[model samples]
Target: MAIALTTLVAEAQRYLNADSISDYCPNGLQVEGRPNVQRLVTGVTASQALIDAAIEAEADVILVHHGYFWKGEDPCVTGMKQRRLKALLANDISVLAYHLPLDVHPDVGNNVQLAAQLGITVEGPLNPDNPRTVGLVGSLDEPQSARDFARRVHQVLGREPLLVEGQQMIRRIGWCTGGGQGYIDEAVAAGVDLYLTGEASEQTFHSAQENGISFIAAGHHATERYGVQALGEYLAKRFAIEHIFIDCANPI
Candidate 1:
């Protein structure tokens, strides 16, 4: 069944409460394409490879977690930007990006989805003071060794997570999906058994070791892959549109 692009974007924005949160990129309709959309493609990032695959799949719209036009990026449309924009304009495929909103949404959210996949029970936010806290603290069904928890992350995420072992056993854990290593401080302050995130900074190891909190740096792409896919499935079910998820893996 075909769905109007406006209706789809509106429903997504409403579900995510996209307008309430400040985001790096525009939440809905980053680039306008055809008015009616039947085939929708979703991905973690709207990179050129994903765009090409969507074009191959004959998608009318491309929805993703990471979209274009960040706070401090080159404003000019040239080089890679030129090629990407040109492809989208020529093909008439819309781009809808939801950054913080997708991460924070209680349902089809990266943190919650990751929790479900990793078998973590939701407890509360990592930073209770912050109203817009995207990071979360939770408990495992049963306590496992630091090594075993890392193994679990690897098994669930399909990639070997970089483990910074600190404590012997892990129960209380804090996590945010992509590039959220900065939140480790909050987790450390909260005295969680371990902290997990997509990317690790240079000082993340030091923080883990010194604070006696184990840490895991799962791949950013791997950690964030679930939200958009879940959103796609929800939209497909809600609107009766054909949804395709294209994975263009990034090692970093």
Candidate 2:
């Protein structure tokens, strides 16, 4: 029912191929805790709410997609950072996080998981030339109007995405899970009928409009919910330990 914290971390690092992928933050074991883990908590982000929820749940380890110590962030552990680290240290709950590794994993990656949810049959990477590209190109089972595809996105993600309708029906589609509107140009180059991502920038509209490709900006949190859950389930099954996914909802 329980596994060593080191063992769990090693398994996760191996399973996700964490070390091979480059990321903004460290890939695994952001916070050290007890030697053994019986209950594992997983979430999209390691926010204060999630930490509190994990403490209440009596979790021994917290695995997440987003964790602390990002590049360019202030090195000083003050304010919100201090509080988050304090709670984790006090409770002896380990934190393991994966950013790009979770995004690009072929089996449990965010992009692949989103495609499965939206009924998109993945054809290939959004950018074949770039090994680091996290977006993907796929196709709907049938060609649907931009509005119809947007409706499907809303239904699946439980949030109404911002839609910029294009002139054509949505068949060949491209998407990246979080803050990937920057990849719209790559999607356009791939010849997708529509492009979807979590957050859109101002220039994204111009790119979509000029290129005649529909665009959808689903909430970043909503779009990325699945990968961590999938990874949690996989870990629980693999280690025969308890795993709980806590969603501390973020609108953005």
Candidate 3:
């Protein structure tokens, strides 16, 4: 049974609350494709390779984490940007993107998903006052060693996490699933024993050591894969729409 593109877009927008957040790409339907979508493809980024793959698969719509037209990005579509859009538009493939909303969505968010894998039960948002904070604070079911936690992160994310273990138990944890090293201060202020994020800057090492908080740098793309997968599963169950997750390998 094929679902109408309009219906899918409407449901996705409502589910993600796309209209409420200030995001890079326009939340829903970046490019219009067939009115009915039988097959949907999802990926981390709407890059040239992903678009080409979607086209080859005859995907009616493509969903991604990083779409076109970010806040500080080069607006002039010249090089890679131009090529990405060209492929999608040429193939008449609809592009739907969710950024912060995808990251912060309680049930299907990146942080929440990553925490779930780490055996942490979420207590609440990292910043309780800030409704838009895309990080979670939680406690491990039982206090595990910092080394054990780091190993678990590696097992789940398929990469050895860059880690700085503080002299503390691994009970209280804070996590942000993408490039969120900037949120170290918030996690520290919240009094969490450990903080985990995707990418680590050089300054993060200093912050982890000086702040006396354990830090783990799981790969950015690796940590993020779960949210969209959960979202795709949700869409499949709710709408009976066929979904496929396309992984474009990104080390960073």
Instruction: Return the number of clashes found in candidate 2.
Output: 0
Comparing 1 and 2 by TM-score, which wins?
2
> Which candidate's lDDT is highest?
2
User: Which candidate order results from sorting by TM-score in descending order?
Assistant: 2, 1, 3
Q: Mind giving the per-residue lDDT tens digits that candidate 1 earns over 1-252?
A: 898999999999899998888877778889999999999999999899999999999999999999999998999999999999999999999999999999988889999999999999999889999866679999988999999999988888889999999856999999999999998888888879999999999999999998888999999999999999999999999999999999898987
- Candidate 3 error regions (>4 Å): none
Q: After superposition, how far is residue 199 of candidate 2 from its true place, in Å?
A: 0.1
lDDT scores in order:
0.92, 0.93, 0.86
TM-score for each model: 0.98, 0.99, 0.95
The superposed Cα distance between candidate 3 and the true structure at residue 233, in angstroms, equals 1.6
Candidate 1 vs candidate 3, TM-score winner: 1
**Poorest lDDT segment (10 consecutive residues) of candidate 2:** 17-26
84: Cα error in model 1, Å = 0.5
Steric overlap count per candidate: 0, 0, 0
What are the per-residue Cα lDDT tens digits for candidate 2 across 1-252? Answer: 888998999999999988888789889999999999899999999999999999999999999988999999999989999999999999999999999999988888999999999999999999999877789999998999999999999998989999999999889999999999989999999999999999999999999999999999998999999999999999999989999999898989
Residue-level lDDT of model 3, residues 10-88, one tens digit each, is 9988998889988656777777877888888988888788888888899988988777767787779788878877787
TM-score, cand. 3:
0.95
